[model samples]
Target: MEDFEILDFLELQQEQQGIDKTARFLQKQIQNGFKISIVIKKQHKFALAPLQQKKNDLFSKQHQPMDVTSQSSEQTENNDKQGSSTSSHSSVKMNKKLIIPPTQNETPEQNNNEQKSEKSDDDQISLYSKKNCSFEHLLKDNLLSQKIQTGLSFMKDGNQKMALEKMMDAYREGNEKLKQCQDQQQISVLIIICIQSLCYASQLLMDFGQFSESQKCLDKCLNQFEINDFDLKCKIYITKAQCNLLNNQYLQCLDNYNKALIQYEQINWRLEVAKLLVKISFVYALLNDFTDAKKICYEGLQILQSKLSHTDPRIYDTYYTLGCIYYLEKDYDFALEYLNQSKEGFIKLYGEQHLSIIRILNLQGVINHLQGNSIDAMELYEQIVCLYGDSQNIGLALVLNNLALVYLDRMKFKSAKLSFDKATAILKVYLNEQHPTFKRVEKNKKLFVAATLSYL
Candidate 1:
């Protein structure tokens, strides 16, 4: 693909909430025979070179002498033959060789000039490293880069075990590399890689429902990496917030999300700021702080609507959160409106069978049930059962419970009992007996039994 096409692809993936997926997509394109480097080089200003190799190349060039007299004669000869020669090509060649350094046999003055040039190059490299963040080092570390690509490929292919294994190995290798580095700059680069590895590992763990493991990874990152760089620090807070959210620590999650939002705002990362606002609004919704959730969700929606495309998928995140908030507030009409929008967006981006679509569908079903549309609600709930049958996912337990409630509402006692029993079985596999979900299912079963006895 062309540079603009690749950029559009990244934008779309990002809108779909796939930040890390963008690079993996590019690698997949490369594997399919695209010359991605040419496109990347054309768009990015910096040349793609290993930093060490670039330094060595500069050092070697500092010792090669140029003959100014011959250069002058050649240029004069080229001017005479300008009409017959490729003037642009000759001038380019001359420009490229203009900075040749003094040889060992040159005068003492020339040797001093070479030393100054060498020092200047070193200074430039140092400055570049500081200003460019970790890109210089990331681009240079081929093995780390390759491991990341492989790990992500495994992730995309649904080999979660292999993916986690590869990513953990990458993390371990980064640690070893860190121990071998003496230069502060090299150490900084390796640490950046380590942080990146931890981020990926934590995200993977979270995806696999290993919330405790994910939290531990984030803690390790916080302990090892000093929070100095704006982007890295913001990401650390965001990851921690997600872990807290998963663990139902709403207040702690809110604190970290707000911290990340502040950093994003200070950096003028408008998209990230908008995204964090939506996330913080979610925490508010969970805490039943509807006023704050509504306010922040609308503000985030405005930012997204103003800055991004009409079709950008991030708009859906805000809409989904708003729907939940409205549902909590019993604003059923508005809840349905926003939830339908979210459902449509997910379907468009990931097709009907996507897990996210399943969630929106479930919420839509709940809304239908609350609105007294029993037939529609039952249809939606049955659709979920068909789509996610016996997956043992937490969402499946939720769907089953809701479906059981609908069955009970219809006085289908036997079906309700069976559905509640299925939910109880699934929840037991994933949660302890003391879990709230287990207690609720047990109560539901007891109530069903009592009602059946009364009917008998």
Candidate 2:
């Protein structure tokens, strides 16, 4: 028998008894020959045992059938030569075949299990890749894109509060996963859509009278992306203009609004031009330049009349500004007509409970008073007083004070005193005690007192 035959038999036995057990059995067989001793270093002991056992098993199994007397000496010499040749062959074969078992501690089944595990792992990775691609496709068509469109529609309809909430939810949902995705072009498009949605949401917040909240949202949107793009920079300035308007910083508001107007003009954005005209009119009104205010208001009206439908909110904004201008100029009849048109438009667009409607109601009362319809004026004032009873609002107080003045002019001193006192009490709470309006209210109180004394 040759060493190759012995090795083949030992491998068969190892398959039956497991690698570790077969190795120990063969190591004992090696110990019986010529008192061969092994001196294993502590670290090498585990590694050397299996190799030594395999060598011994090969020698014993191959030489067992040879002549034990005459051939023993000659066989020993030949065995040394065979060992060298066999080792050299094994070394060469090692490059092509991985036939050696891992160790005494490793089994044939373990190697099979390991190969199966590696194959399963690769299949799992492939499955995950397919799922990710499908998920991204679904998000692009069904989730993120649809959300962006819905949010934009809500913003356009002046349902800004709801639109902002939805836009922010969409932005957060897309941002984390979009960052990690491999589709660079798709991710870039999604990011641009999200930023645009957020910008619209911020604008809506400004429209809905949440100036600080709108500013914070704008800051977050700008922080998420580069603001250096011309279009995006224009939006940033427009948002800042809205904030300044709400903060009553009229000059800053005018400056930013003009900046936005210049950008819109250069880009030929007609709708944006109309919108900026409305904003500029607001600033002009605040500055008490009613001429400039009326000019801008008419510019917006012309744009809306030509481009937008009758029921559009931009038309209402234009009419509303015209009404405000006439009211400021004391043109009662024209003011009443424009304001009534504005009121109907707003009611159709946003319903009567909106704050914009409240302002219209107050303006209607002023127009009635200017038209000498005391009965109608009183009715409107009483309705507002009921609607916003004890509310701390400077505008409401001003309306109440104006209504009292109407009564005082008619020598209805008792009703005048009542309205005056109510307005004063509200103003005292809502305005600073040392405010200029407080002095005006004091003067009105003195007139009421004098009227009361004369009536008594």
Q: Which ten-residue region of model 2 has the weakest summed lDDT?
A: 1-10
| C-alpha lDDT (0 to 100) for residue 266 of candidate 1 | 45
- TM-score per candidate, chains pooled: 0.58, 0.45
lDDT of 1 by residue, 83-131 (tens): 1111121110111322111111121121211222122211211212333
What tens digits encode model 2's per-residue C-alpha lDDT throughout 1-456? 000000111111111111121111001012222111111111112334553343243223422222323322332211111111112121101113312111111111223112221222112101112124544455457476678668767655645556777778777776665556566445544454556556666655554445677677776655655433344456577777767665555566667776766655544455566667766765555455566567666665555455557787767867777776665555667877888998899888877656566666766765565455657866766676676655554455555665676565456667877877876786565344554445555565775565455445
Measured with C-alpha atoms, the lDDT of residue 235 in candidate 1 is 62
Tell me model 2's lDDT, rounded to 2 decimals: 0.51
lDDT of 1 at 83: 14
Please give the CA lDDT of all the candidate structures.
0.56, 0.51
**Clash numbers, per candidate:** 0, 0
Model 2: colliding residue pairs: none
Model 1: colliding residue pairs: none
**Ten-residue segment with the worst summed lDDT in candidate 1?**
76-85
